[model samples]
Target: MSDRNDNKPQTPWAKNLAIWAMIVLALIVGVSLVSGQNSGSDGTVIAYSDFIEKVDEGAVESVEIQGQELNGNMTNGQAFVTYAPDDPGLVSRLEEKGVTFNAQPAEGRSLMGAILIQMVPLLLLVGIWIFFMRQMQNGAGKGAMGFGKSRAKMLTEKSGRVTFDDVAGIDEAREELQEIVDFLKDPSKFARLGGRIPKGALLVGSPGTGKTLLARAIAGEAEVPFFSISGSDFVEMFVGVGASRVRDMFEQAKKSAPCIIFIDEIDAVGRSRGAGLGGGNDEREQTLNQLLVEMDGFDANEGIIIIAATNRPDVLDPALLRPGRFDRQVVVPRPDIEGREKILEVHMKKVPLAPDVIARTIARGTPGFSGADLANLVNEAALLAARQGKKLVGMAQFEEAKDKVMMGSERKSMVMTEDEKKMTAYHEAGHALVSIYEAASDPIHKATIIPRGRALGMVMRLPERDEYSYHRDKMHANLAVAMGGRVAEEIIFGYDKVSSGASSDIQYATSLARNMVTQWGMSDKVGPVMLTENQQEVFLGQQISQQKNVSESTAQLIDAEVKRIVEGGLARAKEVLTGHEDQLHALAGALLEYETLSGDEIKILLDGGDINRTDGPKPRTIGPATGASAIPKAGTRAGRSDGEPDGAVPEGA
Candidate 1:
């Protein structure tokens, strides 16, 4: 038991106590040495006149004088001390009184005491300096003298290791990187076929699509030493520091040949050099230059392979992506419906799911979710179930979590007047009614009068399948749907009483109409030529010096075409709403009663059937439509007189 206790790790508190104890012991020793120099001053003191009377009466037996102070033994065998005045006759009086005396020097600090007092502060300063230097070395992988050394860390398998089995939703990217793994494992296999392993592979995709994870899987599959560094680690304020670090990194990689080096967000240093207004960053460019040489210079880095990930591939330097440097570019795009199902299954394994939780249904609902989004969805569902003290995550929880993730969480605590509620119901009803009647519009997934995010009400629509492009008819239908809310408000409340809730709707319609005329070349008047310039970064010098792409007459023509398209859609919406005013009132009344309604519920209400009936008609499938998923408004508060209705469009609109 004693040995076991001794071998146990010490806590931080115990270590601190031991260090303090050593410091206190050193202070005690120093104090004792200084005190030792004045050890013989323990006798009782007497006045000078009393000392003179004692000597005259012959009470002093013997005396020792040091400067003006005197120490003597009384004739009664007691010790005493006294200070003598400036009297040269004191020694002669002592001799007349037959007292034996000796002369000595005055008391002062010893040599050792003086030295200890001076060394304490110097020792503390040196200790503090050493402590800071050690901290810098630990944090940067180098002290002040080694500032140019590489900060790359060699990854170890102490944490649960990741492999290809753990990756999903990106099979193509994984397969592309598989060749690199094979080459590293058996170089002779590829050598016999006269094929050289590519020097590097670049992973490009939107964020959270698993670019970094793919790199890790490659390293794991090959069972080679992995060195990980961030691109920003090479840059510093001092000139040439970045370049020196890059060279040091390659040297370390060469020592561990046949290993893999992974750099994340390489665009930080690999951006196009000298493209800005005032040339470019000197340190960053030097670093990039050194990196380019190490990759494909005269001296070949034969056994080492480099893999880098970046989302902004367009901003990177051209030389960095050449065939000799990065031979392969693997795209890790957001997962499709089937791929989403696979990803959902991978994340679902960690959660305890109920019988009604279907992966396919969830995947179909989350059309554009990446792998990270799917994982978060599962975690949210599990958390909801835990909050309710349930044994497993149910379909109901998953549905609620999806709504919370897609829309902003519901704002149930917000207060509103009855008039505001009525207005919101009519506004959403118009959107739902137009979607139901439009042949090319997407089917309504759900519509609600309850406040969500910044909008007082919203209508969410989902496509039957993922759409890569939009048709002309679909775009027109989208325009009509976007205008429906404002059009409905104008018809029901009169033009003067219309609310500002349609601000977002109008903005969406305007942007779409302009893009159709200017970019997609849908307007016959504008012809097939693009009238707008492509958006680029502000740092590019050409953006400042270049002239407008369109002439004055062409610009006027483009604006006129956009106005024509938006008004056509608005007229179409008005015609539809005027012909079906009764249905619009019915939808609004149902929303006031239910607060929320599903597509099936709305269809039943519209068909003159009781939605509360247990045996109501089955929901009919609607045709595919192209429109934004959620249209949110800014002026949700009641009694606001602001004319501007701030609205927002969904992603990829």
Candidate 2:
């Protein structure tokens, strides 16, 4: 009964009509039963004397007697009923009167009652049949017929609000896609120059880089229809369902020429054809094949543009990326510093921001944030402001939001024993102290013994600036900083007293060391050789890999190299922490006292000063030289500082 007609086969009006008809039929049947009961009780009631007079006068057309009741239709065509006394001569009286009468018992079922009981169940069966029939026609039955129908959701002109201006970051990709918008708006502009619009432009990026948003922006800018669907939509459990859907989608696209078709996460169906264990007969492969054919079959001059977005472009079929198909590939990488600033501004438009909030500062601190991350960061800041009942979101709120996003929500409800708290304080202090001294390490921004996220305590360092590539010293310094806590523990509690709290730290350092030797070829022994082969689908967020063509001895050598690097970093960490033992103790005490410390307070403490920094001796320079002198001893496979093996150590010793 709604004004809008749904594309679904089941119409609401039809369903309502069936329901109303069932109600009306039930009402009519009920009324008929009531009227039948009333009719059986109709006619006039008479006393016993009146009945006798009628019988004697022979005015009754017919008479019936039963125990104490008499009923008859008179000779004048009048109907009457009367109650008789239980007299033995009642039947004889009727005989004497010579009236056409018959005696009957009163124990038979009513005709109307029997008819209603049978008819009610029949009507119920009919109503049930209609209900199921409509259900079948609505979805299940229609599904059998609609397997070939496109599932893409079409957006009218007004449905989309995103335009090119609304999308920030990835400037190069934005510029590359601008022409497609122009082509959609006026195809003749390019045709006059004997040029055809690119058949397709594939947007490739890591997740949350705004690839799908860019596609929607293109549609909005072109002011054309937009059809959005996921790659999985074309696939179904049936073998050929995917191919049929692909064909149907193209057909619909042709009808809406000058429109855009955006298939997000295209890698779901477009993965390499023979990559699966099932071989080429897989439904996904078939769907991908049909998609290739449709892209090839369509004419670019017809003004239809297909834009597919996928994070795993490396796994896509080659045929789908051929020259005549998706010839243009755009990389939508994570936003850089300026790009992140712009993204923040875009998201901040609706937020009531205090004047002190600086996007550039936040952007600088967030080195590898994507556009989506920046938006979430801004929104989180706004939410924090609202939670605090503030009129405007301030810079402090943004800073808090960033911490929450990076580290996680503060776990205020978590309780820790006094000994555990002290141990955590020392562990975080060790990290902060080492980060400040490591030349290649990022600056220590904050340190806290207050539990946050899954961590009991944390030390956070904000990158000074974004670096596109990592240097050898930076990696080495990062490893040493990661091991600093364990080293500090070793110095304080000795080897046997170390806790398992540094498990995550050890894992991170080991991964870095392994990557250096295998993937990065940074190991002196590996000599720029790739000892490990990364799978093509690394962009899928899974780091699956296999060893390259190498002998077992070579693999052992690689493992030894990784172990050597980790030990060297650990030795360096031990040297730094041991040399600055007093400073480490001071920092840990400050953390224990306050439960949290800002980067500025840490810097002051590192300068041999207190938190207040009023009056204290000028501190020694905490530089890379604190542990730079340590080196591997000759003829030793282990990390040796002055001819002594660096044993496995606990954190914050």
**Regions of candidate 1 where Cα sits further than 4 Å from its true position:** 1-143, 365-368, 373-400, 494-496, 524-529, 532-564, 571-582, 613-653
> How many steric clashes between backbone atoms does each model show?
3, 14
Candidate 1: tens digits of C-alpha lDDT, residues 569-619: 898888889999999999988877776778888889889876684544332
Q: What is the lDDT of residue 206 in candidate 2?
A: 85
Using lDDT, give the best candidate's number: 1
Each prediction's TM-score against the native? 0.73, 0.70
The global C-alpha lDDT for each of the candidates, from Candidate 1 onward, is: 0.77, 0.73
User: How well does candidate 1 score on lDDT at residue 342?
Assistant: 90
In model 1, the clashing pairs are: 441-625, 442-625, 504-647
- Residues 478-596 of candidate 2: C-alpha lDDT, one tens digit per residue: 78888887787778778896777676667667877998998888988878887753224354787566534777787788889989999988988888898899999999888777766
For candidate 2, the 10 contiguous residues with the lowest summed lDDT are 623-632
